[model samples]
Target: WQAKKLCPELVLVPPRHDRYAEISRQVNALYMQYTDLVEPASIDESYLDVTGSLPHFGLSAHALGDQVRRRVREEIGITISVGISFCKAFAKMGSDLKKPDATTEITRENYRDILWPLPVGALLYAGKRTCEQLRMQGIHTVGDLARTDRQALAALLGRGGDALWLAANGLEDAPVVPPDEQPAVKSVGNGRTFPRDLVTYDEVRRALITLSDEVATRLREAHMMCRAVQVSIKDPKLKVIVRQMQVGRPTWQRREISDTALKVMAANWREGAPIRALTVTAENLIPADQATEQISLFDAVPQKQREKQEKLERAVLQLRKKYGADSILLGPGDEEH
Candidate 1:
C-alpha cells in the first residue's frame, strides 16, 4: 500500500530462486577460470582471491577487477561491484562501498584514509545494535574502534569485539573458502504452517509424523543420521517454544524422529492447546555408516526386531522409488503388533 502511494506506477516481479541459482553457477564457472579460490557469498555475490592468479594473468589487482567486471557485464548481462583488499573483511567492506559496475580498492597505504572516517555501522559484521552500543561508548567511526583498547572492547562484546577491532585496523586474515571445502551439513529439518490451528494430540502427532518423514528422507539421502531431535511448536497466538533431546542412538528413521518429537511436545504442551505451526529437526548429524549403538544383553530380541524393521523400511523405499513416492505407505494397521 505504501509502495503504491510512493510510486503511482510500479512493477513487482516474483523471485525465481532456481533461475538465480543457474545464473550463479554460470558466473561461478567464469570465476573458476580466473582463480581456484572463488567463494560464493550468495546467489549474486562472490569473493575471489586473485593473489595467485595475478602473476599468471600479469595484471594488477585493480586491472583484474576491471577485467572480471567487464566480462561479467558482457557475457552474463550482470554488472558486479568489486572490492580489492588484503583481507576478507575489508574486501567485503570495499564491495559495499561502491555501486554497480564499479571497483573499490583498500590497500595498506590508503586503507586508513579511505575507511577510518566511515561510520562504525559501515564496518562488516557490525549491525545496527552493535553500532548503537559503540556510539553509547563515544565510538562512532572505524577509526574510533581501531583506537579503542582491545581489553575494553573484549569486555564489551567478548570475542566478537576482538574480530571487529581486527577488521577496523585492516588486520583481518580470514581466507576465502572454495566450494568443495565448504563445511558439512550441521542439521536437516522441515517445517509447516497449517491452514488452521491443530487442537488435539492426534492432529499435532500427524503433522509431526509428516515433518519427521521429510527430515528422515533428507538424512537418508545425505547418508547421515541424527543423534538428537528438536521440535518447534507455535501457538495460535504466535508464541513459540523450542525443545530438544538426545535420541540415545543415531537414527534416520521417521518412527524414531517422530517419537522423539512427540515426547518433546508432550512434556511441554497442554493436552488440547491449539498449534499454529510445527518444525521437526534432526541435529548432531554423522555419517550413517560410522554410527554405532551399544546393545543391551537383555534386549537382544528387540535389537534384532529393529534391524528387521529397518530392512522392511528399506524395501518399502525401493518399491516406492520404482513406482512413485505415493505408491506405498504405512497405515495404522501396518504397525507391528
Candidate 2:
C-alpha cells in the first residue's frame, strides 16, 4: 500500500483473487503437514489448533508460532502476523496486536496485564460506539471496564453491555468454528486519471473508451461477464458523479460496455466539468458460459474490430504468461487529455 501511495502516477491494481487462491493451496497443504486442525479465517489469516502437535514439532507453542510466520514468508511472497493463546478469543486478540511479520502470545495468568492495558475497542467484537459509550460513563479504557460495575453496565447497555463486559474479561461463550463453503469473487473494475483535467466530450469519450475496453477485455479473459456497468466521474473539487446500470448478462463486446458508459457519461455529467479521475466498474459477474448475450441481429459491428479485440486479449495474456505482468500494455492505451 505504501509503495503505491508513494508512486501516485502508478495505477493501483486490485489483488488478483486467482493468483491468491493458487498460493493459498500451497500454504494450506503445508499447514496440514503440521496440524489437521487448521482453519482458514480469511485470505490473509488462519486459525490453527496445535495442541497435539507439540511433540512432533519438538518445540514450544511460541517457537511453533515463529516457525509458522517463517513458513508463510518463505513459501509466499507475503508476510503474516500470528497470535497464540489457550483460547480462541485471546488468540485472535493477540494476533490483532501483532502485525506485519510478527507473532504474540497470551494466557490466563497474564491476561489482565496485557489485554486490560489496551483500549476497550481492541477487543475482538467491540465497536467504536460501545467504547465511546463506556467512556461517557467514565470507563475510558479496558482497565476501566474491568473495574466498572457489571450489574450497572448490563442495566445501562442491556444485552449489548453484558456482552461487552464478558468480552472485556475474555470470557466469551461462543467457540471458534470453521468456514463452511467456498468464497466467491465480488466486483471487478479499473480506473485511471488524466494527465490533466479533460474538459472536452471527445477527450472524455476517448478516455471512457480506453477504460471500458480494458475492463471488458479483462472480464472475458477471466471467463466471466458482468451484469452491471458503473461509470464514475471524479472532479477537481473532489466530488464524484456516478451513474449505474443493471444489464441482464455478461458481455465481452466492447460496444456493449462502451455504449452503456456513454449514456452514463452524458446523463450524469455536466457539460464543462473539470475531471481529475475516471473509473469504469463492471459488477455482479457470472461465468462466461452463463453470461447473457446482448448483440442483436440488426446491430452488425465490424468484423475487423472484433478480430483486433480478440487478438489484443490473447497478446496481453500471452505476454503476462511468458514475461511478467506490466511487460506490455496496449500501446497508446491512454487517451489524450
Candidate 3:
C-alpha cells in the first residue's frame, strides 16, 4: 500500500490470496453462465470452455467474454479479464497479453502473428532463468528461438531448452486436463542456495533443519503426506549430488521427514568440503488419511524432547505466519566461504 502511494501507477495491496480465491469462485460462477467447461488456472486466471454454449448465450465467444468481465466488475467489486480460446494453454497466453487487468482474444490464425515476434519472456512457460540464458545467447525474441534447430537448443539448455523451442513454435501437446485429475496436492520441497560456501557439517545440518521445517509446514497446510524423500547438495564449484529414499509409509510427520533428511545429509555430504547449496524434496504425496505409520523401537525419542520440539515448532509456525518468512532467526549460512 505504501509503494502505491510513492508511485500511483503501482498496483499495490497486501496480497490476500484467500480473498482473491473467494472472488475467483464468484467470477468462475459468472463464467459458467456462458459455459460449464471452465478451468480455473489460479485465483486471478481461468480458462472457459465455451465450445458449444455460444449459440444459446446469444453472444459470440468474444461477446460472452466481455459480458463475463463486466459482470465481475459490476457484481463482485473486482475487474477480471477473460480469454476465449480452443485450449487452456492458449487461453492463458491470450489473457497474459491483455493483462493490466483487461481481457483479450487470439484465434488460431492470430496466435502465430501475435506471439511470434514478442520477447521470449512473453511466452507462457518461459521462466526468468531461461529468459536470462536466452538473452545471454543473443536470442532476445521468440522468433529467434522458433527459427533455431531443436537438437542444438537441447544441447545448450537440455530438456528445458527444447520445451522453449516447442512453445515458441506454438506447438505443445498439453491437454486441458481437469483440475481434479491434475492432483490437488502434488509436491512439497524446499531448496536454498547460500551466498557463500559452507565447510562445516553442523552448519549444513542447521540449514537442512530449517528447510525441513518449512517443507513439512507446507505439507501440513495442504493436508498432504509424502511417501518419498530426497536430498541434494551442490559443491562450491557447483558439482551436484542427490539421493532418494522411500519411507515404509507415507507421513506428514515432520519429525520423520526431518530424521530421514538429516540421515541423507549425513550420508551424502562431503566430510569437510565447502558446499554452496542444499535442497530437500518430498514426492509421491497423498492425503493425510492415506499415509501409513510404523511401530518404532530404538527410533523413538524421549517424551521430554518430543514435547519441547513440538512447542518450538508451533511457536515458529505462529511467528512466521504472523510475520514475514524471514522474521524468525535460524542457523548460520551454509554456503562455502
Candidate 3 weakest lDDT stretch, 10 residues = 328-337
Which tens-of-lDDT digit does each residue in 247-269 have in candidate 3? 66676655667678878877776
Error of 3 at 220 (Å): 4.6
Backbone clashes under 3 angstroms, per model? 0, 0, 7
lDDT of 1: 0.87
TM-score against native, each model: 0.67, 0.56, 0.68
RMSD of 2: 7.5
Order by TM-score, highest first: 3, 1, 2
**Candidate 2 per-residue C-alpha lDDT over 1-337 given as tens digits, one digit per residue, 9 for 90 to 100:** 5666789788877556557766777777777778877778766667778888899989999998899889879877677778888877678889988688788888888989998888878876567767777878988777788778899989978888887788777776554444443345466688997768988887788788778767876786677788888998889876888888876445665556877887888888876778999999888888888754556655456545656766766666676656544455433433111
Poorest lDDT segment (10 consecutive residues) of candidate 1: 328-337
A best-first ranking of the candidates according to their lDDT comes to 1, 2, 3
Higher-TM-score candidate of 2 and 3? 3
TM match of model 2 to true structure: 0.56
Residue 176, candidate 3: C-alpha displacement in angstroms: 1.8
